[model samples]
Target: MASDLKVHSFEEVAKHNKTKDCWLIISGQVYNVTSFMDDHPGGDEVLLAATGKDATNDFEDVGHSDSAREMMEKYLIGEIDGSTVPQKRAYIPPQKAPYNPDKTSEFVIRILQFLVPLLILGLAFAVRHYTKKE
Candidate 1:
């Protein structure tokens, strides 16, 4: 939640490229440059090798467009510092909603559920019999 929008230079990002999905949070923007690493024209090794250093330099290396830079601002949540990065949890499964049983409420709900259909069926039967007689 820090306000200082740190823009990382490309050199710094290159240092930490080996870390796989190592991200740089800059200017309140988050860029997952992982997929772009291997195909970089500047030789993938340079970015791949920047595995551990501070990536302030890498971000600066890739200059931003006026519109892109403005859009990038939205993704920045904070830098991938040791504290934040290490604490980040791996991909977790989606959590299913818990079922809470309330006996009194459930009983009433079940009775209403069953009674509604039965009521409709009885009404239909009564209507049909009266129409046939008529």
Candidate 2:
């Protein structure tokens, strides 16, 4: 469907990251989404936040239905130039030793995690108890 569309450089797309001129890249395709921002069911900020960046992951993560996908076609402006598209960095979670419930530091953190919330709850109850109407 996009066979005849002109390719746009990332630099060109990035220039449109404002409310009145927002653009987005999704799966290497560039789209002028300024008009769609206000119409977005998720609200304009979500679409605006994705402006000037590849939003394929965020788009797919939301599990948008087929109708949403079809709606996006109307906004397609061009393909992002392959050489100019930014490459995503591979994620490597920090390697940590297996969690040990018995470790002193881990035990302390676990106690704090539990006690902090419990303490807050107790304090709230105390305040409510003291402030109750006669």
Among the numbered candidates, top TM-score falls to: 2
lDDT of 2 at 12: 95
lDDT of 2 by residue, 32-60 (tens): 88888788889888988887678889899
By lDDT, who's the top model here? 2
| Count of clashes in candidate 1 | 22
Worst 10 residues of 1 by lDDT: 79-88
lDDT of 1 at 24: 49
Q: How does each model score on TM-score?
A: 0.30, 0.64
**Candidate 2, superposed: residue stretches over 4 Å from native:** 90-134
Question: What is candidate 1's lDDT per residue for 1-134, written digit by digit as tens?
Answer: 55674545544443444535655444324455566566555666665544544444665687746875565445453454343332335998999877656866899899999999999999999999889953
Model 1: residue 108 alpha-carbon error in angstroms: 99
